[model samples]
Target: MFTNDTPRQGLLGRFVAGLARTRQGLAGQIGRLFGANVPSAEDLEALEEALIAADFGPALAQQLMTPLHQRLSRRDLSNLDQVEAALKRGILDILSGVAPPPSTMDHQTRPQVLLFLGINGSGKTTTIGKLASRLITEGGRVVLAGADTFRAAAIEQLGLWGQRVGADVICHQAGADPSAVVFDAVQAACSRGASHLLIDTAGRLHTKRNLMEELKKIQRVVSRQMPDAPHERIMVLDATSGLNALVQARHFHEAVGLTGLILTKLDGTAKGGVVVAIADQLKLPITFVGLGEGVDDLQPFVPETFTDALFARS
Candidate 1:
């Protein structure tokens, strides 16, 4: 996995490689517009269209371009470098508008609890495993709670990850009470002196009302034992879901007040700009981004790195 010790260029290269599809979509458009020209008003308009095409949403696309349009009219934007620089600046401003997530392992709160939420097929479980693997590799003990008891396969999947990562897993039989599993997981993590407790909750979106209330119940269960616990209510969203990913974040944030996001499936999606839309609209910071299937691919979300990779020529 990637750590702070990793070199900057190597890390940026990994991000660029992962965002190839997205770069091909958005950066491709920018490349077409900037060329050797000073970029006319019509050219800027076309770039705005490309932003929307990349799933930045119409409102944000316009918001991002309006300033460049003004600078262009005032003859401030001189060349291709200025155009790309202006766009990258606009993106970083929005992405860093919110504060970053707090430290993952707070010693005072031993067993820093993290709960993962998302709709089915959002790569929620896999993200948890990858994150837990990183935590353990960092010399932190992790106890995983398999609260997604709705599906037998989910419980089994979590167990497999637990074994693979050498973390203890607390799960119940399929269809068992999810809260009960959480209650036990909290106790296990506390007793074992674990540094973190990661819970994988059910993603049964079809049971809408029940699922939302169930998530709230899980929070309550964790709080009863360790107040201010469940320290991170992070949503694991699929970047490929596009606008629907934004919609999913809205629901989870409204229901249980999500603390941050971990976007997955960025490896093959051209709609990675949805990352911008989610952050711009919801004000939730993205914690991690899944670039590939390997555990090492889940890199900590770096706003500058992501923006550079997004705007890099494909």
Candidate 2:
């Protein structure tokens, strides 16, 4: 479990670096809009447009600006720093309101199941590999379950990650029943005394009905195999996809009740505000965020640094 233990100072630097694109754009907008003696209606409207353009979504963009609006109404913009501070505080509030409580189990329970869900190419497999590598480095035992039986390549890719990370990979022949793979994986994790079991589920979202049902089946199988398992149902999203990511989250959340979120490619998008939109709309905790291609780039989500990173100056 990341447990956001990457150290605050280090995490802040990583977040600032990962959010470079977003910080440049958002910070520039805030500075330019509020640089004047007092913010004009036009400036406020432009700020809203910038927030929406950053993929905060129209409603959240408006909702998040309430603090800034309050300052404007109260003629409290005398302290220029307060302008950006209010925006940061607003975003922080949205993120913090949905933050999940810290994991108390702390990998004490053997074979804690984690279900990875997303559409094809959402970096689900890669994220799993990175997570396994981290857990193993921290001296935790991990088992990778290639539950995506539809693709022979996915099974092979997960196997490679397992090998590289020195974790066990449980997979059936390509085109086998995914649920069967999940069941066997659970058994293997227990028998091997692994601390965590990461299951890579099918991502064929084009067939919504078939894919969702298969995922539900896998969830049911895992639940019966190990009680109170699938402890984490994490949906991986491409940050570049912005609001579209929310659509996928809604689908999976409604289908099997996602417990957390993982946004990938954070370093590649200027629209990181989508993070706030998803958290506010779904009310789910974001466990980890993929900042870059490196394994360590997949760091735990620290809300304070993440919010600060959005407006960090060069």
Candidate 3:
């Protein structure tokens, strides 16, 4: 029901524009450091500090600085071009190494299931809506499963997205058992021959063991309905949360084995380097990035484009 007629010529441009804050905060410092002369030890120290402040985290910041330091010692990085190129290469290496595997769903898999998990305020709901829009535009039938029954507003939000995208939403009343909702939604998706089923789970912190157990129960129900159901368990992360996002990811990955990540609010945060941190530390592929509030702003993760955007001159 959604149309893919919009021009995509500006996707890269939008990606670049959305990263303005991050570039200004992180890359701008590097640019200033490399502007005039070969960087001194003091300059390298400053660069390391900048990287850390950008939320690359201490370990990754050091990992990135190591190669540059080696190049500096060997007198290989003499100019701004070499300096910028080296930094860019380092970032790309970290990101590409953990790139997510190709989607498991094919034409034969009538309903490829994706389960979304994250703490509240991580944009899980909005990510689902944008993903549904993308799937529908690609000529795929979608069924939204509002499994976040703990919150009535969560169900209403998903229903609105379903209506807007012309996808069916399977939901029970507020406070309904989430596992039951998932079971019913799985059955409905199979019966309706939907190509994709997106399940939105309750947004609870990883510290909440009871809620995590509920998530496992929902997974069990879905698996019972179809052995290979819930093909992807994705955790949505807020770009602004910095290292805390990594903590959330670690817990969720342990709880349900997260297959990928979706990072939202990139346009609003200067800590976009957290993406690199997440990839390097968690080894979780970032599947998509929410650049802005628009439905079309959710773009697939491309390491080259992202690194370029991050380092591109303002």
Worst 10 residues of 2 by lDDT: 99-108
Clash count per candidate? 0, 0, 0
Q: What TM-score, over all chains together, does every model reach? A: 0.95, 0.94, 0.94
How do these models rank on lDDT, best leading?
Answer: 1, 2, 3
Candidate 1 at residue 129, lDDT? 90
After best superposition, candidate 1 residue 114: deviation in angstroms?
0.7
In lDDT terms, how accurate is model 2? 0.86
TM-score of 1: 0.95
Per-residue lDDT of candidate 3, residues 1-314 (tens digit): 22323344465687788888888887667667757677776777788888888899998888888888888898887776776788889999999987654452343666988899999889998999999988988888899999888778989999999999888999999989988889988999999999899999898634589878988998999999889877889999999998899998998899889888999999999989899999999887788889998888888777878888887765
lDDT of each: 0.87, 0.86, 0.85
Estimate the lDDT of model 3.
0.85
lDDT of 1 by residue, 231-257 (tens): 889999999989999998998888889
**Candidate no. 2 TM-score:** 0.94
Q: Which candidate is the best by TM-score?
A: 1
Candidate with the greatest lDDT versus the true structure: 1
The C-alpha RMSD in Å for every predicted model, in order, reads: 1.8, 1.7, 2.4
